[model samples]
Target: MFGPWWKLGVDTTLLAFEAQAVIGLRLAKLAAGGSAAQVEAQRMVSEKVLAAGEAAMQIATGASTGAVVAGYRRKVLANHRRLSRAPKGAAKP
Candidate 1:
């Protein structure tokens, strides 16, 4: 009866968990401490904000929820890839 509703909650929780892990890793990288790292962190924030704004605009223009979500999902996966990779010649975490 409540399967769809419960599934919605479960899916949302999983997405949050995944995003949190990526965020934590990103913070750990930033914590290594350097001007370049800080700058890169700021840039990442700006990129996310821009993407969110774009998504919002798509919704305002009557785009389907799935389309907006798919776009954001792509961005999140891309960020995860970028954040999880070790920079060239950098020490392992």
Candidate 2:
């Protein structure tokens, strides 16, 4: 049925909104200043670029919107877990 596709569309929209909010918060934190703020900003840019490239490749290979979005959600959650466990001022290499 069309129900699944409709759900996927809604989920994708929600994901996009969540990602933007998180990115905005990160930018605000960076602007507020910290020893590792510069590194965090650079990491954010690199991560987004890499994720976009991967998503584009997946779409080119005929992956569904749901699949691409799920992948993004997984990556974002993993990064959140990793960052949460790290020391406050530590920057990952």
Q: Which prediction has the highest lDDT against the true structure?
A: 2
For candidate 2, write residues 28-88 as lDDT tens digits: 6688677667878888889999999999999999998889999898777666555546566
lDDT against the true structure, per candidate, is 0.78, 0.79
Backbone clash count, each prediction separately: 0, 0
How do the predictions measure up, each by TM-score?
A: 0.73, 0.72
lDDT of 1: 0.78
TM-score of 2: 0.72
What would the per-residue lDDT of candidate 1 be over residues 1-93, giving only the tens digit for each residue?
997667656656666777787788778878887985798689888988999899999999999665666676677778889887877798985
